[model samples]
Target: MLDTGCSVQGEQGDIPKEHPVLKSEKEVLEKVKLEQYQQIASARDLTDEEFSSLKEAHDTPPSERYAMGKYRLMAVYNICDTTVVTAQWVADYDNEHEKKVYRDLCVLSTSKMQDGLNYIHRMEQLSLSYSIENTFEARIPHKLDDSQYIKLKYAVDILAACGFSGPFSNDTVTAQTLNDNVNQYWELTKDKMQHTCTTLGLKMPMPKKWVFKCQLGFLNMVLHSVLGMKIGSVNTRRKMYHLKHHPKV
Candidate 1:
């Protein structure tokens, strides 16, 4: 009869092989099997000195929601969002838009190049280290320094105003193209947003207390007044005879 070691060994329970598990833990938790949990615990954790060094290496603040990765950068650029404005649209923006982008960029780019470079370097590290299924897989800028966090939020506000939506793929190629050209598009987005501000008679150079109101009700009234009258909807069509004869209400 073949001795199946099952009787005594199983009854006594198998001794687990030892391994070290750290407080920081490996980022790829899914790859670890359930059985490995017992083995890892059995292996014992590292010594205090070793653990201190490892913890220092991986210690992130409790508030940080997102892991550092390209997806974070993708969210920063609004590439992961459903809407991606085309490179063609970016290139062909009107002068007013261009001017606004230039203005915004001037403010953003004024930050020390050394700081910007440091942020970019960190991004590159995170991008290389992590691959996320979506932008929401990690929180952002929580892990970033103050300057980097400001830039991320500023970029989101500016890019959205210039017609780029948040991260997620409604159009992959357009998103990828924009992602590849983000640095360049920064200038373009700034310009486009500036132009929009100008069109709406917004104060320029963006003051500390600057504010914008869409006034949708007023816009809807205008549309209602003009609709079905054969007055072209284009805002800048100066040749419209009705506009010349219109009363100043």
Candidate 2:
């Protein structure tokens, strides 16, 4: 979950002094109004027509769209991530200078690849604790200076193979990576884990696949609680069905 309420910790310590992208009060306000609409849609699951009607009605003479846009940008920066803002009062201005601010803000806000990488790390730790029986080790040879895009891609591939998705797979690395070697040590040998439940006399109580689903659901719940995003109910139902059909007696 994205920490929307986290504040910038100190005086913009490391941010470059002359970077661009800030907005005026008018643009900020416009953006805020739009975000409100987005929140309303999310909260109420409103239809397109309903939203359009609301927007049309709200549109007024001497429109404050510019101000609203600026407000929305600031709000997003203020809440989602604070590494973007350079000046404190960029959102207050209404002149051409405000355009520069808006431009800079857009660039900074969207360039959060590092943030995504950090999320991958968190997901990896959570997955290992939930699924693997052994402790996690740092075997994957990740570059300390690798681009965020590469890190994100690597994490996604690892997770998909492990039968999970989203941030859950953030720690997954290529099979040839050193991390894979470490993971192998922690993973229960499949034959051993399945032997008693599958080979025998005892009816397996729950299938391994189902167990994974339950884990995924639990993970999803954690993410929703933390990030404010909703996973679809269909996915939950599918997981439950898998568990029921593949139970270990």
Candidate 3:
């Protein structure tokens, strides 16, 4: 007989009443909320400002929480990666003068790519310590240099011209130029680089592909979290739907 952890005193029909697994969704959500509160209440290191923000999130409706409170949690835990955040905020600003000012404040020198190259190198080393489950735990340098950022944004177009071949695989000198920064930053062997990329479910582009994907992923988050865009196209639900067959359209 399988030794079920449930008490033998309870009859089979009564088991669902007491079993935590069988609880209603409302009950489960309440339990989770209570546990979060307990953890926050017991935390010794939370500052007054951090506690206030967390408490505000806790009181917020499930549909209305900011970045689902993960940003605040990361901030409190000292694991927040601000590199992409700084870049995004700089890019997203509407006022040109303000954007320039913010970019100058957050990013390194515009003339030199060395700072961005160094940042990528440190991030690559940091990723070795990250597990698949807690990959975001690696604390990277939170700033970038302008030249490298522009190169990263335009790399997709360059890769497109090369018939979308893997990074550094295309023989064109221009295509190979894209990999030069990566090559300079890489301290490990080619085999180790390939292994790291494979383990992370990443392409051969190493840090470029990884960082590009991260920037795109953050944009997706903003679309869904801030703009309330769902998985399917909103155009499909309209009265006069165009390109009804293709969701990608």
Candidate 4:
């Protein structure tokens, strides 16, 4: 009699290898026609009013569309945990906007800073390679230097207002807090900030400070309200330890 294990292995080894069928030109053409028909059917099914409404909605700008989509998604999801969901939403939205803003700011700031540094580096290279008198005399005008300095100062101020501080704080804040604070801040002073930044030609950093403040507020809310965790405890650990040891009240 054949061993059961040997028979099973033999059956497994005899598994069929089925190759995927490559579509012919005729098949491809038929698929294209089918897709086109589906599209036409979908378009034809829509009423004139529906089509107009869809077109109007589509015409809305991306920023507005993003806002609408986000709110609609939130309404549809209706997640029970407001804290987590709201935080996630803020984080997602901020990710899209903040990433672009921060990246652009970094690029612009780094480019200008690097350019200035490069000039200094080049000057150093020249000084090392040849005497100062022998090298081409290229000096940054005091006015231009002063203007750049002012621009940098303005940028730093904008950054501070936006809430960008340093590494330690930014990572700790929740997205919900970031979103709420940013929206509030933006609504209150966006136009003013824009005008000021444009006038000064300053590159603003990411709003780290706003994020931190919002996060702190959220943490306080969670600690005091939701979780009921207090900041200080009067030997609660000792009380629990005694209760465990004594067994009776």
**lDDT by residue for model 1 over 42-77, one digit each (tens)?**
332244464455456666442221122212323333
Q: Against the unseen true structure, what C-alpha lDDT does each candidate score?
A: 0.34, 0.37, 0.36, 0.37
How accurate locally is residue 225 in candidate 4, as Cα lDDT from 0 to 100?
A: 23
Colliding pairs, model 4 = 163-207, 163-208, 163-209, 163-210, 164-207, 164-208
Candidate 2 lDDT over residue span 1-249, tens digit each: 898986676555544455342335557788886554443223322244654555576563323443343345554444343233323233333234343333332432353534554555665556556544555464332433322233234323333334333432133233233234324422533334233223222233343563433433433332232222223323433321111111110
Sort by lDDT, best first: what order? 4, 2, 3, 1
**Local accuracy of candidate 4 as per-residue lDDT tens digits, 1-249:** 776664454463454444223335557787765554333222223334644565578476544444444343333444334343343344343333333333323433444433533454454455545644566455432333323333333333323333444211222223444445446645655456544444433444345564534433332222222112212212534211000011010
The C-alpha RMSD of each candidate to the native structure, in angstroms, is 25.2, 21.5, 16.1, 29.6
Superposition error at 213 for model 2 (Å): 7.2
Instruction: Please write out the lDDT profile of model 3 over residues 1-249, one tens digit for every residue.
Output: 998786756566756665666667659787776555444333344455755776766476533243334344445334445333332232233233333333322333332324533564565455544533475643432222223233232332223332333222322233233344334323333345454333323355424554523433322232222112211222533322111111110
The window of 10 residues in a row where model 2 has the poorest summed lDDT is: 240-249
Best by TM-score: 3
Going through the candidates in the order shown, the clash numbers are 18, 41, 0, 6
Off by over 4 Å in 4: 1-149, 167-170, 197-249
Candidate 3's C-alpha runs over 4 A off are: 1-26, 34-117, 123-249
